[model samples]
Target: MKTTKRLDLAIQKLYTAFHNNTLNPECCKQCAVGNILDHTDAWKHLSDNHGSTTLNYIGMVNQKFGKTFNGYSPLELLHIEAQFLKACGYQLPLHHNNKKPKNPTDKEVLFLGLSAVVQFLCKLDNMPDVMDCNQLFQFQPQIKTSKALMLS
Candidate 1:
């Protein structure tokens, strides 16, 4: 299957699970295919605290595709999502710290992340860049983290 199609299917599965309250760790493992958590605390928090099913799915996707998911906290996942989004040409509104805000509410962050992934895939396919924020959007982009940030 095409990568985009696969991503869409995964997202749909996640949403179905969430709406049905079937987002337990076991369910996630079966549906998300590389989710790291053994239980549904992350999903629970995502539902109760964050508002976007898309963000929850992004977390699941990162666990599956990004090797960093094993020991990551939820906040870390948000940061990774932000970095991923920025790489795809979304000019993230900077927080007061001149960085993307930490631990964004799921509603505030999920669509941006999903859009980023779509954008990245478009870049991979050599499509014309559609994002309007950064010049880097025109090229094959990489997520960049400073050494200090990485060490923190």
Candidate 2:
């Protein structure tokens, strides 16, 4: 399968799992992947309790990919957040502390997971640049739009 198709499949799987409540956040909570996915919502990154867990995922991804993120700079965290925002179809704010809209839809969560998977695949495939890594998003298919969902 093409990389885009493969990644899209993974995103769909994640979407199903999330809607089915099949993913256990416990699996990645302390690790970087877990920190971002398991912890935050659409609007926020730094939890007063969690305090910007992006660094954790950075170290983990770097370790897994044999790349180094150095984990200490706020700029590095912003960079990762940029990728995630793109994947989530969100816009980057001028202020790092600004929050996004609350009550993220299932699609949002899955796309976020897709973002992480893309990062992981990039590491695994040794294709780290944005142009290369972004191909993972070429086939991103939304299972359902908000209009189809019954909002309470």
Kindly provide the TM-score of model 2 when superposed on the true structure, using C-alpha atoms: 0.31
Structural similarity to truth (TM-score) of each candidate: 0.27, 0.31
Candidate 2 per-residue C-alpha lDDT over 56-118 given as tens digits, one digit per residue, 9 for 90 to 100: 444445545654322223334344444444444444442336454343344555456455645
Best by TM-score: 2
Pairing residues by index, what is the TM-score of model 1? 0.27
Model 2's C-alpha root-mean-square deviation from the true structure amounts to 11.6
Give Cα distance to truth, residue 91, candidate 2, Å: 5.8
